[model samples]
Target: MLYSMSFPLSHNDKNKYRYSHHNGDSTCKGIDVHEIFMTKSRVRLLLSHIGILVCLVNCYISLVKDKLCSSSIWKITVIILFAKFMQYKPVKKESLVILPEFGLQLETHYWSGKIARRFVPGGKILRPVLNECVTPFTCYWSLALILHGEDQLMLVFQELKPPLKLLVPIWKALRSSFDVKEGSSA
Candidate 1:
């Protein structure tokens, strides 16, 4: 069976966020796929295009009006800053594919149609952890893997940090797959 759900990232966010789970079938035995997608906002995409167009027009006018004047240099610098600010995120979605009898596959999909994937064998995965990451200005929840013989935790969703509400179900599913006992962090 395939289960899918979607909601806003936040009250003020205009972007659509969704996740889906696909249960394994006979073709791919014992495989479970969990995916989270972030759709780009049309308004934001339009604004970014307009901003880039305006920046290019201004840059050409400034360069033509004064070849090497200080004013032209300043104008170019401002245009570059604006272009950087208007840049859109490259990642489109991320997925976790669990093969209970084999291992886990982490997949990242980019807006440029590129997919980056990594695999970890079932034996190498010590545990699935839910971490509270604290930054100077804010805090967020993250899902990670405690791998055998590895010092650093492997983050499941590298580019997109979905909320705890989204991470809990995945965490539970992972724990169940690994047969992890509750109240034990061994």
Candidate 2:
């Protein structure tokens, strides 16, 4: 059986994000898996590229029309670089594959078709925790793992930060898979 849930994007967001849970099957050799996909809109991508092009064109026009000095040229270059940096998102998806008797697999899928995975054995999983992170501008929640030997907690989702509502189910599933009781360490 498969279970899925999608959260509507806020007014300011252009991309759609959702996460799904897939039950494991012995016959197919599939393990219980939960995946969060970051879907990019083609129109949005096109528009962003167009905006960057327009910025470059305007910069060129300014140089020709105003005979800008080196300082102004440097300013234009900085703006273009900042714009490119802000628009770059390489992660396509992130997943948590549950291996019942073994451990959990954390997978990160990149836009360039690269898959990076990390495995944490069941014995090493001290517990699953939900953390509320506060920033000066915004607040967010994150799911993390407390490994037996690791001093620092490992974040479940590295690139794509899913909201608290989407993270709860995964946190519970992880707890259950590791046979951990509420408010108790493994």
TM-score of every prediction relative to native: 0.79, 0.78
lDDT of 2 by residue, 131-172 (tens): 998999898889999999889999999898887767888998
Q: Name the regions of candidate 1 deviating beyond 4 angstroms.
A: 6-10, 13-15, 55-82
Best by TM-score: 1
Evaluate residue 133 in candidate 1 and report its C-alpha lDDT on the 0 to 100 scale.
100
Candidate 2 segments whose C-alpha is farther than 4 A from its true place: 6-15, 28-30, 54-77
Q: At residue 71, what lDDT does model 1 achieve?
A: 89
Global Cα lDDT for candidate 1: 0.88
lDDT for each residue of candidate 1 in 1-186, tens digit (9 for 90 to 100): 788865445864335567888998778877889998888777888888899999999999998879859989999999999999997777899999998988899999998999999999999999999999999988989999999999999999998878877888899889999899988875
Give the candidate number with the greatest lDDT. 1
Task: Find the 10 residues in a row with the least total lDDT in model 1.
Answer: 6-15
